[model samples]
Target: MSLRRLLLVAIALTFSFLSSFVLATPLHIIAAENFYADVAKQVGGEYVSVSSILSNPDDNPHLFEASPTIAKSIAQAKIAIYSGIGYDSWMSKLLAGHSHLTIIDVASLIGRQDGDNPHIWYDPHTMLTFALAIKQQLIRLDPAHQASYQHNWQQFVASMHPILTDIDSLRQRYAGTEVTATEPVFGYMFAELGFKVRNLGFQMAVMNDTEPSISQMKGLHNDLIEHKVAFLLYNLQVSDPMTEQLKTLAQTHKVAIVGATETMPKGIHYQQWLKQELDAVQKVLKK
Candidate 1:
């Protein structure tokens, strides 16, 4: 071949390689919670790469303040997933100028209005919805990988069957069981399992990071003394004097105590962390 013809062929091959590289690059995603990060990974599979802003297992997601770094992440991400429901209001503020990115507000997709509990992951049904929504969004971004995303989601749904079964069993075993928490972190899960939450005021106080009113504290004390609650659930991350007082009262009144964490600790997978939490609840409630 002539030198000119050889140069043209080489250029064509280089352009083809560059096109393949561009097409194969993973879709960038930013997830608000660690739990959603796991779900995003499963649903997106190899076609998407995810970064969770609140990754520290010890950090209370409610108390997280957004920084410039997080803002940059949000600006560059093609898809952003947030728990919403007023839980991560900072996310909305950060996303205001980014009109090109597709935002998946989990709360909106799940039909939660303002003041609704944002811990949707604890509800298996809600999680199923989240997974489906994620799969659909990912397919829209990369149609070539639709089959892979759907397949992975189907497997995820199947894998979660046991968790759903366990939830049902818990509901059957602990129906009408009275529980109290420092915050509403686990209220949705408790409600799903048929447990009556008796300390909503106290939990809401802690969730909002404010001192409970004297009346609210007095009411919680009364519930403890009157044996109105069967168990006390506390978030491990937040340090609340009221929760500490309640812990002491729980021990004195023989009320079971269960600690719940928002993040899955290092070295523990999503399923294992959830199973551990459910086991703690089962053991405490069974007593």
Candidate 2:
């Protein structure tokens, strides 16, 4: 090649590198749930500015109403992390008006199947997939931080290895252990741990916002009375009269009660929240 041509190519490469280095900006990310917000923050590190729409732990995620302020947040967001499974369908309405933003639908990326539980975050393996997807999206939005994003993701995954190991250990220890849950929030996690679910129909009815029949409730009560269940997992949010009644029954019948939360409460991080959940399960199962 001619000297002038070689010099021009070198200059172009140098300018390209310099542009990427100078264009680094904090990523504006809007996450549907607090869990995704935490995961995105961990992966994006200091290069991201995150906001979550449904952050209240006391609210029912299944029946959340999106406000105008949330719509504006979505409009301003450069990237959005949403849980698709008909849980956050409002995001679709918001995205329809503003189509330029890159929205990452966790359900679509992970392949949502019929009868597939929407609580994907409870599954540790799915969280790893989410981390990789978040890393890729952040890298795409801010190529200059690609190396940093990758490094953060690697560290996050490495940190999750111990959690995965704990999950496996719990699975072996609690295999075939039967549990009854009022809400289906922990269905995926319990299933992963090889625990037998006693009231699947009841849980599904509650999850879909339908009322369970008297016979189903009676059967559940009988199961508790018969000592067929080892634990009674209940949602910390929502005051279901039936669930409250069942809680009393569980107390009377000596069935251990385990409270699970769909959203992390204030002042607790992701790791701490998950550790508390697992510890609750361990304590319930041991008794």
Please give, for residues 1-287, the per-residue lDDT of candidate 1 as tens digits.
99999999999999999999887778989988878888888888888888888889777787789889988878768999898888888888888989988898988888999877777777767778989998999898888889999999998898888877888999997899887887887877897889888868777777777888899888788887888888788887766676687789988988778998876666665666677888899997777
* Model 1: colliding residue pairs: 182-203, 183-203
Give all TM-scores, in the order shown: 0.89, 0.89
Candidate 2 Cα misplacement greater than 4 A, ranges: 1-25
C-alpha root-mean-square deviation, candidate 2: 7.9
Please provide, for model 2 over 122-215, each residue's C-alpha lDDT reduced to its tens digit, 9 standing for 90 to 100.
8877788888999998898789889999999999998887777878999988889988889788988887899989888888888888898888
lDDT agreement with native, every candidate: 0.83, 0.85
Candidate 2, lDDT over the whole model: 0.85
At residue 161, give the lDDT of candidate 2: 78
Model 2 TM-score, 2 decimals: 0.89
